[model samples]
Target: MTSSNIPIATPTFGQLLRSPVLLLAFGFGSGLAKKAPGTFGTVAAIPLWYGLQFLSPVAYLAVIAVTFALGCYLCGAASKKLGVHDHGGIVWDEFVGYWLTMFMAPAGWLWALYGFVLFRIFDIAKPQPIGWADRRVHGGLGIMLDDILAGIYAALVLQGTAYLIHML
Candidate 1:
């Protein structure tokens, strides 16, 4: 929701396709926080993480893989329609990205914290190719690719953390 007395006009389905505001608004509304939407969006993955962790590591990886692939298409179309790239609310990329970050970490608070920090850092920093992808790509692929990079970064950091602490 925009923070103004002026009401936002609703876009038709056609218009929404040209604008990312609608889809991102819907996705990030899952958090509904006035504070950092990205942090809240990452927290929003907790319940999902609990449910998904029941499966094996391979299953978790598969889920992230499939979700990322599908999100690429969906996010690209939404961004194309909205004419803005990587609007804040389309945190489906964030969701899968965090899940992927957690892939190597063992299930527990330590692993969760590691995932949270690494994903948040990479997501916020948008280092190297992440920034490149965000700027260069258009549509859903653009929206999703940076987070995938974030996930990979987080995964590596988690691996290093595990080694440092001897958790691996």
Candidate 2:
């Protein structure tokens, strides 16, 4: 059945609390916001990115890899349970995307803020392949792919900007 035909309701906080998958998928409750849920979800990822920054690069990448794998499953499962395709409340993808954007970032809150802004820009703009993936893909992987592209785009711009500033 087409996603449009699926009958689904926004999951309640109680349901999110009851289900581990839902909890993570909803970005630790940030996705529950009535307005700008995705933005809230991305904001919720900041603290997590802070802790992750302490890890060695290899370890950090490993963690991201594992989280991405788990997100694929969790996001897909949550979408299925909700009978929705990439529900706005499913923001595990945002967590992963933000983490990816922060990879190798400079050690400062300024860098983190820059990464956040860049990631949000690319995510919201959905330029080229990012938008293509969002329209063409399905399931959990689909939900994650668009954000992944956005993260990559943001990461490139962030790193380039950092490099230019450092060289100045």
lDDT of each: 0.72, 0.91
Count of backbone clashes, every candidate in sequence: 9, 0
Q: Return the top candidate by lDDT.
A: 2
Candidate 2, which segments miss by more than 4 Å at Cα? 1-7
- TM-score of predicted structure 2: 0.94
- For model 1, residues 54-165, the per-residue Cα lDDT tens digits are 8888888889888888788766654444444555545778888888887757768878977898899999999998999878987777778888899899989887878888
Lowest lDDT block of 10, candidate 2: 1-10
Q: Please state the error at residue 95 of candidate 2 in Å.
A: 0.4
Residue 104's C-alpha lDDT in candidate 2? 92
Q: What is the lDDT of residue 10 in candidate 1?
A: 35
Compared with the true structure, what per-residue lDDT tens digits does model 2 show for residues 92-155? 9999999999999999989888998999999999999999999999999999999989999999
RMSD of 1: 5.6
Cα misplacement distance, residue 123 of candidate 2 (Å): 0.6
